[model samples]
Target: MKFLKVGRVAIITRGRYAGKKCELGEGLKTNSETEVLTEELQVVIIQPQDNGNKSHPYPHALVAGIERYPSQITRRMSKAKQTKRSKVKPFIKVINYNHLMPTRYTLELEGLKSVITAETFKEVSQREEAKKTIKKTLEERYTSGKNRWFFTPLRF
Candidate 1:
């Protein structure tokens, strides 16, 4: 009923938006200066949609949160591949948050490996008590880590 595992970030190579997938190689709290060319993105598991419905179609992945990446980072990553860089840059570091929802972005996962299985995602949202425990645990985890940031719940 509790979630101990942390989320990971990756780039969206192919989707409806194709090359415009949010850049997640960097963690969720990357700064504009460190954002060579990417957006502030997070990955989380969500319910899968049924095939029969059309209107108000259910989302296969629920968007928890979303924010734009630093402009510099977005520009660099979106640049056309003309020359190979000397070295492949490592994933950027962003502040980690606990008990906080991840940013929601529209990403088609038709062919990509999701961070967590659908079953896992549903189970987490099903129980209120479990959700609270998981959030607290995650908050502890985030605080111990460096440059981690937790979100205060929104009033809306």
Candidate 2:
């Protein structure tokens, strides 16, 4: 059974979020029917390539939805403006362990675990709120000048 700590950053290797980056947030039982429980875990996608869910083709949606850093945030910007300018679009998913390629980075944000979860994706309002949480945390992290590599877009 895999038992990885929450908050480890990883890249999705399959499915709609493939090639995108995310942070491990919760550990879930891979199965409960036959397994002893304690296998796979869930993640919070911080830098997604496209519509991580739904039937839409990943390539088509990825053209404009990819982002891994904080956009310019000026003091003059209003709350609504800031929210609109944010490029972060986080998704919470309880995916299989094999699909995630763990990285050396780990990012722990306040209220992240509470706001982001597999259920957060069930409703549009919840997803939007979670996105806002992710954006705020990321902006804070970026401005604080820590976890530089985690926030940088992958090259090549």
lDDT of each: 0.26, 0.51
TM-score of each: 0.25, 0.59
* Over 4 Å off, model 1: 1-56, 63-126, 150-156
For 109-150, candidate 2 gives per-residue lDDT tens digits of 666666655456567897678677776777677657676565
Q: Lowest summed-lDDT stretch of 10 residues in model 2?
A: 57-66
Candidate closest to the true structure, highest lDDT = 2
* Model 1 quality (TM-score): 0.25
RMSD of 2: 10.9
